[model samples]
Target: MSKIIFVNLPVSDLNASMAFYEALGFENNPQFTDDTAACMVWSEAIFVMLLTHDKWKTFTNRPISPITTSEVMLCLSCESREIVDELNDTAEENGGTADINPKQDHGFMYNRNLADLDGHVWEMMWMDPAAMTN
Candidate 1:
């Protein structure tokens, strides 16, 4: 068996959040989606569960984090620097805020950060495979 990750996020608006993720290349799994939550798949092993405030509260009593404050930053690796840029751009086009942090670029690696409609931070990055050998 292989391990899989399900990142659960509390969203103010489920539909909007789902759309935002869809623009960033995530596919909604209707099998697990409902009025209160949505299952967004990033890859075969990576999934994001977008839950409404009420649904989120059921899981944890903790208060929801403010959009201005980041509890965590999720990072996604891209095939190339171009793909990283494309995802960032797509996010911005779909109600997300792009370049929340300054862009980072090294000869072998490149990264950019974007914030979703609910202010969840997602870092898009690309690294040269050849550089990994060094």
Candidate 2:
């Protein structure tokens, strides 16, 4: 079996976070969901557990970083620039805020950032396979 488990970062609002991710097209896995955490299935092998901060802390002793002071940004890939833009748009529509970084067009790759409810940054990107070839 594949060692497949994506980290579930804590958020203040589980319902809002679930809605936010749902807007981006990920389906909810009822099998792993409860009032405090929702298992969001990105694909067969990839999943995101949107947990309430209080419930999430049961697994760790580390301090939860405020979104404004967070240093790490999570990056996700898209198939095309249009898809990148679409996700960002949907995120905002669902209450996610945009990152300060401007959209980048490297000819082969396009990228942008959006900060979710708890201030976690998520980078949305697209890369052209043809341009990746030498």
Lowest lDDT 10-residue stretch of candidate 2: 92-101
Name the regions of candidate 1 deviating beyond 4 angstroms: 132-134
Q: List lDDT for all candidates, in order.
A: 0.94, 0.84
**What's the true lDDT of residue 51 in model 2?**
84
For model 1 the local lDDT of residue 78 reads 90
C-alpha RMSD (angstroms) for model 1: 1.1
Clashes of each: 0, 0
Candidate 1's error at 84, in angstroms?
0.7
lDDT of 2: 0.84
Tell me the tens digit of each residue's lDDT in model 2 across 10-126.
Answer: 989889898899889889999999998999987777798988878888988898887778777778888888888888888788888764468888898889998887888888989
User: Each model's TM-score?
Assistant: 0.96, 0.92
Give the per-residue lDDT digits (tens) of candidate 1, residues 1-134.
69999999999999999989988989999999999999999999999999999999999999999999998999989999999999889989999999999999987899999999999999999998687644
By lDDT, who's the top model here?
Answer: 1
Pairs in steric clash, model 2: none
